[model samples]
Target: MRSAYSVETVRAAERELMARLPEGALMQRAASGLAAACAELLGRVYGSRVVLLVGSGDNGGDALYAGARLARRGAGVTALLLAPERTHPGGLAALRAAGGSAREAAGGALDGRAAEDGAVAAGVAELIRRADLVVDGIVGIGGSGGLRPAAVPLAVLARASDAVVVAVDLPSGVEADSGEVRGEAVRADATVTFGTHKPGLLIDPAREYAGATRLVDIGLRPHLPPTADLEALQHADVAALLPSPAAESDKYRRGVVGVAAGSARYPGAAVLAVSGALHGGAGAVRYVGPAGDAVIARFPETLVSAGPPSKAGRVQAWVVGPGVGDDAGVVDEVLASDVPVLVDADGLRLADRAAVRARTAPTLLTPHAGEAAALLGTSREEVEAARLPAVRELAARYGATALLKGSTTLVAGPDGGPVRVNPTGTPWLATAGSGDVLSGLAGSLLAGGLDALDAASVAAYLHGLAGRVAAGEGAPVGASEVAATVARVWRDVVGGGWAAPSAGY
Candidate 1:
């Protein structure tokens, strides 16, 4: 599993590491790793035109020191200091000694002195345009809000250039803890972070700005705590959570997932939900809705019932509200049941807030930004901007596990543990029936005995993988194809000598 720390945690860990070592030792360690990464990106550093966008912080110092190393390696490096007077003296001296050049990017001719940030500004843009690589050290994790007006132009110039932009530490202008980019922020081709992975580098908005991320170890792991602020599960971690059938296992012994979805107008929602459940490691699927004929037509294995979910046979877990429209009856029946329940789509709107909170059994809510905004009584923009806070608040308000689905899917529980961030997903997953497939899949995992958080995380991971497979080579794929690919993905995850069956769906 990959873990991400908040900025405060990273700083605390760095402090302890720094105290244990000699002066400047940590900086040297950071600089060496950064220079090596830049060298690798540049392919051949010798004679390469490298420009460092220097600011007034340690991140700028990191860039300067790395630039000094590149200078020593015969790269024609230049440091464009945003704060020339506040530049790192040691790093500046080292660069000069190594035959590197320095210039003020926003003072005198570059600043608004003579012709309104004159010929030097144009000259700096040209340098950025012609450079082989641009190192972004404009701001660090400690900086917040957004880029200043002066630095904004630098960011724009670097982006306007074809140079490969590499960010030092966290990308400038992105909130290191929140992953929010309020105003202007540097969008790099790659980011080389030191010590540990910052939360911003792993979450969205900021993660998007950070095109590709590389972590350089400076021996700070020993100083960090065992628990992290955020966690992302790898294949092995997910494998352990996967459900498997034993030699003596029977269909009833495995687990049963009940799905309550669909309407006369949207019968395909029922078919799609059942399709996901059948492949989602569940022993049997019990369907209770008005679309029994449509579901049975798609999959004969489904146990369908026209009655309410209370009489829809025993279920380890229930998934309600895909295309149920305005039917609040089924949602109330599922909530009243003793089994765990996953609420989504129409269910999210129909289920009473008090009923959801008062449920004795575990509840999992899956909501997109718009749905979440309605639940929280806020705007969609507010929820989307503060996704971490929104998911946590949703879980707290509903007294259930909440999964906020979007570019960066987040799962937060009512118990207030570290949030699990899902790093997989495709924009193509925003299809008609894709969310219904996800609800069924997560409900199956819950039936298979995983908790709400595990169920949501694993489901999101598999759903994303299936989406990628279904949308192979950038083609638009149907929701049924995504469901069809889930079984193939499940086999790939657990590796039980199981090959993907041909066209069973």
Candidate 2:
């Protein structure tokens, strides 16, 4: 599992470790790691033109020292200081001592004098354009909002260049704690993060700004706490959570999932949900809805029922609200049950807040950005911009585990532990009926004896991998294809022979 801590926690851990080490030892360690990453990105450091966007504080210090190391190795390093007076004295001296050049940025004060506007802009642009690599050290983890006005042009120029842009600790101008990009930010080809992962690196929309994140060990692990603010399950971590039947296991013993979905107008939703449930861990799927014929035609093994959910027979768990439009009564009956229930799609709107909060059994709420916005009385744009807060608030309000589905799937439990961020997923998962399939898969896991948190987390992990398999090489796939591919991924995961496809972080 990849764990992420909050900015405050990371700073505390860093401070504790720095107290035990020599005065300049911690900064030296960070500088060495940063330099090594920049060198690798350049392919050959010798004779390479390297440019560093230097700001005030330690973030700028890291880049300056790193540029000094590169200069010592025969690289042509230039430090573009955004704040000359406030720059780290030690770092600036080291760069010059190593034969690296330093100059104030265009538009910045130069020796108590300001240069011509056009000439300064051209100079800045030329430096970034000719460089082989541009290192972003304009902001650090403690910085919030977007890049300052003085540094925005540098970020813009770097983006327009052909150089491989690498961020020092995190991409400049992104919120390190909330993963929100309120204003303009740097877009890096890669980011070198030190010690533990920050929440911003794992969550989006800040995650999208940070390219491929590489963690460099600065030895801050021992001082960090055990519990993390966020966690991403790896292949081995998810494999151990998978359910497998014993020799004495039977159909009933394995568990049965009851799916109450579909309407007279939209019967396909029921079929799709049932299709996913059949392949899920549940041995038998008992479906109770108006789409009984469509489901039976598609999956002959499904147990179908009519009318109220009370007569749906014995089911260990229930999945409600795929496409049962305006059927609030059935949702109420299912929510009244003692078993774990997963509420999604139309159900998210139909499920009563008082009833959901009153339930003693586990309840999982799955909502996309639009649905979540409606539930929270906010706009879709707001929820999408700040997914972490939205998901956590949903869980706390309804007193149920909330799964916010998107490019990065997040599962937050009602009681507030580390929110699980799903690392596996392709953009192709944005197709229709994807949420219905996910609802079924998670419900089956619940019936298979996994808790609400684990069920949601494990289901998301498999669902993402299955999406990748169905859409091999970035081809388009329907929801049915994703459902059919679940078993294949399950087998591969259990056998420890699966490979994840390419996806944007």
Candidate 3:
């Protein structure tokens, strides 16, 4: 499993590790890793032009030290010190000794010369434009609320340049804890983080800016707590959670999933949901809804009934609301059952908050940004901007496991714990009826005896993998194709053994 910690936790761990090491040992280790990563990115360090945007923190020191290493290796390195008065003095001297150059950034204290600001800004811009690589060290994890006004132009210039931008520890200006990009922030081609993964590196908005992330071990793991603030399940992690049948297992013994979705207006939703459930490790799929005929026609093996879920035979779990439209009665009837329930789509709108909160059985709520916004009485943009807090609030409010689906699917439990972030997916998975398949798959996992959190997270992992397989070569894939490909990806995951997660999602 890949884990991520909050800024506070990472800071504490860093302090603990620093106490055991020599004064400059930790920084040297980080600088060595940073320089090695940059060398690899540059392919050849010799005769290359590299520019460092140095701030006033340790991040700036890391960049300066790394630049010194590159300079010794024959790279033409230059450091634009944004804070000349507060820059790391040792790092600057080391760079100068390694035949590197340092210049004060534009708009900073420069002998009280206002006329030089324009010329200095132009020179900095030219240096960035002509560089082969740019190292961003404008801020670190301790900084918050996005970039300061003085550093904004440097971020903008680095992005506008063709240089391969590499951030130190994190892309400056992003929230290290919440994965939020409040304002302008440095966007890197890759980020080399020290110790372990930060929460922002794994989650959205901020994740998009991080590009490819590489972790450099600095002996901080032993100091960290066992539990992480966030966790992303890998291939082997998902495979271990997948339900498998024994030799003595019968169809009834394995499990049965009940799907109560679709209406006359949207019968395809029923067929799609049933499609997902049949391949979700469930021995049998029992569908109860208005679109019974459509579901039976598509999958004759499905046990279909044109009545309330209570009359649809005994099911281990129930998936309610994909295309049920305005049918609040069916949603109510499904929620009234004793079995585990997954609420999605229109059901999320029609289901009562009180009913959901009072349920003793496990409840999972899946909602897109717009739907989540409606549930929380906020705007869609707001929910998308602060997904971590929004998802936690939803789970706490409804007393259920909340799955906020998007480019980065996040699953949060009712009580406080690590929020599982799904790291696999293709942008093509955002098709119509795609969420219905996810709802059915998660509900089936619940029927297969996985807890609400595990079921939701595992379902998301498989669903994303299937989407990637279906959308090979960047072709547009339909929702039906995605559902059909789930079983194949399941086989690949279970049979292929463990595979580490790729760089960017």
Candidate 4:
């Protein structure tokens, strides 16, 4: 699994590690790694033209020092210092000593500089246009909101240029912690980050700005905590979390998932939900709803029940909602049970918030942006824009594990721990009955003894993989087709001869 820490946590770790090392030791280590990454990207750095957009922080120092390294290696390097006097003195000297050219964009002091309004703008644009690589050191993790006016045109030129833009630490103008890009931000082709991965590097908006991240360790590992602020599960991690049936285990010993979904009008939802549960390692699926006949028609093995959840026989876990519109009674009945309950679709609207919080058993709430927005009293666009905070707040408010489904699926628990960002999902999965399928799969995993967070995260991971498999070559796939591939994805995840490295860090 790949993990990410908050900016505060990462800075604390950096400070702790920096205290033990000699002055400038950490910066040099970062510069060395950053320079190496640039060299790798350039392939043949010899006689290459590299431009360093130096600012007024240590990030600028890193870029300058990296430029110095490239200069020594026969690359024609130039530094555009937006803050000439404030730029790292030692780094600037090192670059000049190594045959790197340095030019000042600002006429006077930074605060009073008239650079952006002067002829320097033209020079800056020209240098960026002809560069082999443009190193962005305009801002660091501490900077927020967006790029300063002075760096706007340069950012645009770098992005439009043929030069490979490598952001030092993070791209300028992005919230390193929240991943919010309020204004114009440098869109880097790649980012070279030191110590540990920042939340922004792993999240959207900012993550989208950071084309690809290359980590360069400087012995900050020992200082970081055991748990992270966020985690993205890889294939190996999912494989380990997957449940394996014991040799002596019977069908009853494995698990029984109760799916209380569908109604007279939407019987297809029940069939789709049951279809997912069937392949989710559950020993049996007990269906209790008005669509019982429809479910049995689709899957003959399902244990159909015409009555409520109380008469659905014994089940390790229950999956409620997914087309049971206005069925508050069924939701209440399931919430009162001691077994784990997964609420989705219509159940999200019907269930009482107090009852969900009061339940002693594990409760997993799966909400799409629309459902999540309704629960939070916000708009769907707001929830989609601020997914990390929305998911965390939903989990905290409901006192249950919350899975906020979107382009990026996140799972958060009641305790406010690291949110799991699902790395596997296809746009083709965005079809009718997808969430129903997810709910049933997750409920089955819960019955199989996984915790709410694990069940949801693993379910999303598999659900997404199945969607990709079902929609091969970018074709549109139906929800049933995605569900049909669940077992295939589950098998692949658990070392079934066909597995690739998971998507992101």
TM-scores, each model vs. reference: 0.96, 0.97, 0.97, 0.94
The digit string of per-residue lDDT tens for model 4 on 1-505 reads 7888888998899899889999999999999999999999999999999999999999999999999999999999999988787999999999999999998764444465476553354476788889999999989999987987777877888999999999999999888877778889999999999988777887676788998888888899899999999998888888988888999988888899999999988999899899989888889999999998889888999999986899889999999999997889999999999999999999999999999989999999999999999999999988876788899999999899999998888899999999998878888988999988999999999999899999999999999999989999999999999889998888887875556544223
lDDT of 2 by residue, 326-376 (tens): 999999999999999999999999988899999999999999999999989
Q: Sorted by lDDT, highest first, which candidate order results?
A: 3, 2, 4, 1
Q: Weakest 10 consecutive residues, lDDT, candidate 4?
A: 496-505
TM-score order, best first, reads 3, 2, 1, 4
Provide C-alpha RMSD values for all models, in order.
3.8, 2.1, 1.9, 2.1
Candidate with more favorable, higher TM-score: 2 or 3: 3
- Measured by lDDT, the strongest candidate is 3
Scored by lDDT, model 4 comes in at 0.89
Whole-model alpha-carbon lDDT for candidate 3:
0.91
lDDT of 2 at 490: 91
lDDT of 1: 0.88
Stretches of candidate 3 off by over 4 Å are: 108-120, 497-499
For model 4, the superposed segments whose C-alpha errors exceed 4 Å read 105-120, 496-505
Ranking 1 against 4 by TM-score, winner: 1
